[model samples]
Target: MTGFLAAVLAATVGAQAPGDGADQRRRLVEQKIRLVDILINSPAARGAAEGHEADARALIEQGHQAVDDARKALADGRFDEAAKLADDALRSVSSAARRMSSGEGALSESAQRKNLQDLGDQVGMYRSSIEELAKDPQKGTGAKALLRRVDGLTAESKQLAEAGRLGEAGKKMAEAYKTAVEELSRLRAGQEVLLSLKFDTPADEYAYEKKRFASNEIMVDMMIAEGRAAGDKRRLVDGFVEEGRRLGTQAEEQAKTGQHAEAVKLMEQASAQLVRALQSMGVPVF
Candidate 1:
């Protein structure tokens, strides 16, 4: 049952643990399933069942090709690009799901049974993927709430599929997937912000980075802002540049090592240091 869901998951989720290519393979499967769904929804699908079957087969083939492209991207460390390929495959699948929700391919009871079973399988696959993700120390990547959210949605989808209600199940699944993707994007952005703080000479903490070269204090006044990783107070002059760059490097290293949140925190510190140094020099960092 989990055969196809695994593939779609690969595309939707962030990069896997360095060694687990299995996750990538599974996402490819999801793409293939989606391609089948697309062909089934095509205009030619309903009029001639034979034509629909052939087209479905072709879509499946195309989906596999897309998965391959995504897998290569993943292995190459192009996480953002890999994510995009996965998105394309997922979109293909979603398109088919939308058609199904609209009752495009109203099938006989026997066919519906086969289809529901496939959906059930997909649900199972998603559940497994979620479980695997749970093992990662990071609870949530961006929104810091993805794994829990996805798990709840996966469970609901499984129940809907089991009840032989593919349309409702698909809709719920779609929402869940969308949420996960949104969170992933957030996580990426947050990682970019980790450990870095910027100050402009012309601005206080409340007026940070207002314009291209706005000035701010070297140390963060707000608890929401990142503070120095070590020590307290601001640099008297441009003397803090070394400390700031050190923090930035640490943040980048952490991000590269998959401690995305930690990396950002370190980076913010570094940025703040640079801000003070630039201000002392009477230069703009923007």
Candidate 2:
């Protein structure tokens, strides 16, 4: 949480004084109710509900009920009851927010595991490609250093994962994957590699690019939701993602009009923008 938001929450949810007048207590309770509403309607809270996080959903529902009861108490001139109910609502809202925040942490851990798995897969793919290229001794000549670095990074990532430092593990794995990709790109600089997929039609190519673009967009969304892109970077990353979505929309329209070739190009551009967005959030993608 940011300092600004924490300060705001503190101010809104402060304890009522014993000497406070009825109107002052009422206003404080109302502020708390509004804060609860805002918290429960936030994107994270909504996502938790959508994901079937039972505890969070139940808490949010409980908060809503408390808010309703508090409003009724306020109307009936029961200031003490309204204050208590309002506090209940605030407690439920805070619990729900914490539950959702914990869920985000779990999600981050899961994503880190996936990243490690993906890095391992990319390493295998690159090794296989290198072996095939080695058939012509001249093709795989200059990749020894990069190959060693990738191996070292992959090993270190595994060690970090074993130590339960998944965040560090993911970063190491991303570095490994990026290194492998760079080496592969270097090896295939002049001639197309045998591993390159051959598409039978423009539509097939478009489908492939579209899938890639969607995957990249998903990564960008996850990073943004995790608050990885914040402050100044948030705006820049959002811009890239928005541009990517625009390009993706244009690509879909072109594809619908039987312009598969153009659609493929547009989708590729869209995917590139999404990749940039991820990179801006310090995530590596190939």
Candidate 3:
């Protein structure tokens, strides 16, 4: 893409509305574009849009390592080492953005803009997701608050996306994912909470302990108790089917990582979960 288009794109990103609605705008961007669309539509900017993002991932991976080291440095009071590592990671973000916006880069301006927009939307999705999760009764009120960090990131993502700076946006996404995982790791899982979540149904509990298949008695009883419950069998079946798909995907990931034994165990668990999720709604799961 031409310099004029790139400038215009950056300006548009700068004008993005900040707040919850920004996330909805981001989701729209994802539904609208792809990486290959960059190469095909804007040959001049393709490298900046696509190739630089891969480079950014490598940088972010290095940043993760540095952050790990930085933690140790902080604990040991090695301030210099911790500072250096943090600076390195921050520089990676800046460097990646610069490369993505290089005028001589091959990605077309349109492709770069679309790629950035998609990243912004994902960041927004994470931000809004965390906000909504906070309101869920099933979620822990004790979960560590990372909303402020995520908000900063959503803003960065929006800025980068509008600039058609996919490479930087990709790196930001890596950081966002890392922060989210860290936030989850910080959650304190209390014994009381664990016990509260446990199933109290005697028969189901007994069956679980024996590693035996679940009997349909409880489900049937519940259906009978709630007069119109059977009417929603199709919806219930759909939930099972969707959950089964997730378990299968996770199983595939485990296998790919060379944990074949664990993978088999997970796959078996997934199968059981799938069967439990799918049985009796009209499609037989046996």
Candidate 4:
């Protein structure tokens, strides 16, 4: 009886170890899901989806659904199921990434030029929007500084494009676009200019909040990938990302409980945390 009891105690101790197999497996699966999420939401994947690439869209959707199911399985203590789903999600997203890469590689020089032109046009539109906001007395005072930054970025992007550095030009334009959007959002907060959309319902507002949160998530991934969040900054950025994710989860919970207003507010806060994280990494998001 003594020996049997000792064996049982040993087994219990093993099960409760800091590096227990089950806990390790759960962590690994969670990491994979995060990686899959980043890949699916990457610029390449997004470009393909925007271009109406059916395969890319379908694969991205499948990966997202798998990730959702994996999270549910994890919550229910179905570790094996969660692991399988996470693996499946990673595979789907990887395939989509490959497809997007191939499509981009197939683009002709002229096509690339056209893409750059489109980005420039987008920057122009953002500049116009900011200029219009500058005409508003209530918002104009704060818009002046942001407008100057956007103008500088826009000019740099144009120079990059003219120099045949299309890729760099695209990045510059994206930065300018992000700055413009963030400035507009800041200036128009608490007004009908919520991202330039007047929500007809709380649901619409919630949807917009979710979109913004997802965009911020992508920016976080980009910063990490670009190695901007390294050394001591990595830990700080990670803290902000974790906080943002926590708030985003809370926002979803609130939305599910029909507290749409609270949900939108929480989500906005979540996105703000992510923006702060990006800034901490020296990203020129604004």
Candidate 5:
């Protein structure tokens, strides 16, 4: 059964189990333990850890042990003890996960607002970086996929905050930020290889230029797309993106004319222009 159904079943059984059979109570407790286990081991939970700090790991481990003890109690025909242990274990797991999710601690309203604003700024930076990274031949699709997940999380964060679920919203925002950081790390690693390419031979130089040209073409397209998304209010960003595209075109033309070194320089200029555009929007691309 789904976790939701399992939760409902546990609640229903708990309410009526005074008159119901001991076996039923045991099953309900087991169901609850199972649900908690699933939640504690989910990707969202792991991401909430930031790096699985010792305290967080300890709480989660304690919950697991409690659940195990609960199971043993149930087997020994101690229904009340089993149920209580299961419930307590579930709460422990949930509290730990919630604590980790918030990234720091529970935020007051003003703090939440400030933190949200900070996270939003980080998200904007990641969004800009993703636009450039998604043009890479090797890591483009992966970066795009990660950006989709980050977008979903950021949307959820906004929805939660709107509904006055400030604590929950903070957690969601933290998770989104963590995900974006991971994506940025990956994107940087991928690009570092290309950026480090040495033109030791004429063939190697030609290959580097060709690959760089293709990558810059995609980057130009992404920069344009970002500009359009920002609309006319961001005319300055649009100008930067336009200039970047122009430089990309010039780079390609220079490459065709066997001016590979100049072509590389133009590509660097194009990338800088795009980065400047993002910085103009309060996103630090560097």
Candidate 6:
């Protein structure tokens, strides 16, 4: 890859579309290309492609040409065409990569073991984060669902490893880690919203509540959706949900009777119950 070609490639990969249907296809193809690039650029793969496997070398050249053509098509405002060319590149590169080595990335057994260990550590970190969130009582159904998935994946990975299928096991563990990281990010976002509700004065409390009313409503709705989505992975949060609704209603009643301070306290209590429900699902609220 020359400097000019590398610059063009970077620009092509970084481009974002408004709402192109081909965007996903392009992204998937790009991932495949990178994987293939790592394999074929290695000494082992390079030797295999250049020596005793003329077909692999040809495929590598074809893949490079296809990528270049795809970049040109995108520059010319032809996303669909570019996407098809990218797919062609991916296919050629993948064929070459396989011919170069039986394993993905031509990973040796030691490298595979190290990769699996790293993935396990990543999953463990996510589990710790989830457990921390679980200490909260008002958020976590969505995260709990994800935790269940991680558990299943972890078990499956262990079974695969026991059966001597290290490659497949490593892939499953890597996927589990990725899923856990994504769930952790979602829980973190929810935590941020809840933490913003604190106030030091009654006036400040009332003012902040008014300002954040819409956000509070959205967060509540989000919790309900997460709870519903938890399905069989659901936690026991119905009582908390009911308590939140009751407190919110009472808060409204108090406000109607000119009990401003009491109304604010009741409203805060209502929010706390809702937050607790979210925490029960492993979302950290503080």
How many Å off is the CA of 97 in candidate 2? Answer: 16
lDDT of 3 by residue, 151-265 (tens): 6775686677668665566456545644543353344233121211244553333323222111122222222233322455634643553454456557568767766556555
The residue pairs found clashing in candidate 4 are none
Model 3 / residue 209 / CA error / Å: 35
Ordered list by lDDT, greatest first: 4, 2, 5, 6, 1, 3
TM-score to native of every candidate shown: 0.27, 0.41, 0.28, 0.52, 0.34, 0.38
What TM value does model 3 have? 0.28
What's model 5's overall lDDT?
0.61
Candidate 2: pairs in clash = none
RMSD of candidates 1 onward, in order: 22.6, 11.0, 22.6, 12.1, 19.8, 19.4
Question: Relative to the true structure, how large is the alpha-carbon lDDT of every model?
Answer: 0.44, 0.68, 0.43, 0.69, 0.61, 0.58
Residue-level error in angstroms, candidate 2, position 149: 2.0
Q: Could you give candidate 4's per-residue lDDT for residues 146-254 as a string of tens digits?
A: 8899889888988987897766676676677667766776786666642355789998889867766665665576567667776778668877877888898899999
Q: Which parts of model 6 have CA positions greater than 4 angstroms off?
A: 1-95, 100-106, 192-286
Report the C-alpha lDDT of model 6 over 1-286, residue by residue, as the tens digit: 1122233244444333336466665555554444334333433334444344567677777877887787787767677677677767756765665553454334455645655665675577567777667666665676677778888999999899889787789768866765665566777774452222346866556544432332233333344444432543232455565576678778768777777688788888777776666666665543
Q: Whose TM-score is greatest here? A: 4
lDDT (C-alpha) at residue 34 in model 4: 59
Off by over 4 Å in 3: 1-106, 136-144, 163-166, 185-286
lDDT of model 2 at position 203: 96
Better of 4 and 6 by lDDT: 4
* lDDT, candidate 5, 1-286, per-residue tens: 1234234334533342353687787767766665565555433344334344556566667778888998898889888888888777776666665565445433346645655665666566567778778887988888889889999999999999999987678668766865675557656763452223345865456445443333323333233334432545355765675687678778878878888778777877876776666556544334
lDDT of 6: 0.58
